[model samples]
Target: MYDQATIGARLRMLRKWRKLSLVELADLAGMSKSYLSMAERGERALDRRSYIAALADALQVSETELVGGPHLTKDPVQAAPHATIPQIRTALIANTLTAPLADQARPLPELLADMDRLDHSKYKFREAGRLLPAIIDELHVHAADPADEAEHRLALECLIEAFQMATFTTKDLGYGDLAHIAAMRAGEAAAILGDPINRGKADSLRIHTMPATTWRVRLTAAEQAVERLQPHVKDDTGVHVLGMLTLAASMAATVAADASRARHWLDHAAELAGRTADAPGDNWGAFSTTNVNVWRISLAVEQGEGGGVLELARNVEERRLAERRGRHTAFLTDVGRGLARDPRARERAVEWLHRAENVAPHKFRNDAKARETVGVLLQQVRSTTAGRVLRGMAARMGLPH
Candidate 1:
């Protein structure tokens, strides 16, 4: 029943009741002026859990109380004609964003439920992306506190995952800039919680945002993050090491872009994954040997090594088919693009690209290199209907026009 207009009205009421200007509220809440303005106007939505908590804290009320009903019902405190922090937070978290509360015993179930809800919801990717920054800001407010550190950390991780989903699900979304900012913020928050796994995840995202042409910048960020995390790497028997190894391998892959370098990194990553597997623990973030293989396949495709790509692609396909969750849409996109460039494999490459698109269009939409590969295939099938469809898709995705 909660609508954007109602949410905006409540936010304004709360600010006025507290006698705080928008600038003051934004400063106290650690958000930008523009975001605050949009929230007050109900032009923006909140999506991050931490942000909701922070808004609740700033308004000095429980999130449940703010959204469900105002406190002190006996006297029937007049519904303050203003926005309460908690109300704003609740409205945003419940309506705009998709981050779930970290249920200590039911985190995965909670996340799955939320994901289902998102799938069924009316919100589209463009709207969701627009709401992310404010959600991140709200999450920041809660994450800054030393108390409730574990809950705060989990919320941050959830936010990071949500951001990833937003970035990966929307075609031609133009969210790379926002993704970088959110990843950096998440990294800072993860660092505060002393959770190396989250920290490494954030680092990986940060590296991903770097342009491939700017290898030096990416290398420096990766190396620095790894060095900073050196102390945490001693214990390699948990999900933490898997994240670290993935971050390292991803960075090394960016550096050399060669099969040998990639193989070395994957070997190390596999070793760490194996050690973690030997320990009695459920894998966090789905870290496993198969993940290492995916990374290896991606690298081989990147390096343009035909035999390696074919072998690795076959392995990935077989494993992914066996494990429904391990499907690497990004890796398949790479393979398709690679084959699309070669005359012999052009048909096969188009098939791969088609499959990749079906799986996740957003991931491959903005990739210029992939578009170039598809372009080659287009030339071979100039008069075919498939070529026209491919060309149209490429244009829409901002690939070579």
Candidate 2:
């Protein structure tokens, strides 16, 4: 189970342990003393990566040390995902393209079919956890020793995707180290396959799975990814990959608080989205007009532009985000978190957060930001019913209410 203490509680303990006064720590972190106090008192939300990174640097600790995670919950549905993380870690460590650990693997066709079904695992965390380790092992077998050149290339493709799935599953479950391993393995397979499109996709995974720190470094990496992939973007798949890269750049710039750079990348992504429309069924990060708007809302929230977030949310054609359950839930949670930052919209924040949890219980319940939003809403619970709902959500997240 996760530590019941909130992030603020952890920060307080860490600060006192380091023997740093509030003002001293604030100065070190480049924030006002009062603002740091509010965060320590749980009166401010620590949902922004920038906040976490700054404090981590100031305190001489990893960001994960501040924002506790890999929260092993008691709920069976939620716990299932964490259960498989160990096996995924083992598979990532023990296997490689040259000498796979799995003694036997299924035929290439069977492995491909499994990959198709596991696509839904993007939202179905439990299902992904249950299947990913074995699939990764089997795919590695095929990748290591294919029946033909054609099958060799296809097997490598499947292997890269399996690693991508592993990347997301571990990262989502808060196993950051394991997620990085998976991403590196994916990049390895992409290189062997020698497909520029697949290579870009693997690059995206690596960038996205990076530890939530060093925004400027991440931004530079994203820009480099765009430059490397731009020449190969001749089809919808390439465009989707390139577009997602821009979205990644936009997000990194937002966290760095470079407003002009952020908007420039966002507008560039919007242009690419226009070309591809909505590739809902595409496994290439689901790049679309709707997804770009989703990122827009999220960036606005990160910028603390609550009003702009709502305006953008209202304009989103969410229906067009079909089958992209993760993006849809992200949209809802972003709105909820954004609104929770505003004292005037606490009630609405609760409603949107509830909707988000309803849409993807496991995803929403495990999300640090969603939990942070719930904590924020709980602070000013005005209605009896809203209080009851928020408490239930808190209980599921194992938060002290």
**Alpha carbon lDDT of each predicted model:** 0.49, 0.82
Candidate 1, residues 1-401, lDDT tens digits: the string is 12112233466777788888888878876777787686565444332223444565676654432332222111111112111324323323343222323212234336545644443333323234444434444444443431464666665666665554443332122234444554565555556656765677677666766533445456566666655565666554335544544545564554444445555556666776676652211344445665566666656555544433666776553433222221345567667755654557666666777776655454344333354455444446554656766766555443343
Q: Which ten residues in a row have the lowest lDDT in candidate 1?
A: 73-82
**Model 2: per-residue Cα lDDT over 1-401, one tens digit each:** 56676677788988998999998999998888998788777788888888888888888888778888678676765566677777888889999897988999877788788888778555556677888889988888888888888888888888788888788778877888888888899899889878789988888988887777678988999999999999888998899989989999999999898999999999999999899857655637888887888888888888876644688897778776656676778899999888888888887888888888887787787787787768766777778987898998888887877
Worst 10 residues of 2 by lDDT: 120-129
**Candidate 1 TM-score to native:** 0.56
What number of backbone clashes does candidate 1 have, counting pairs of residues 3 or more apart or in separate chains?
14
* The best candidate in terms of lDDT: 2
RMSD of each: 17.3, 1.5
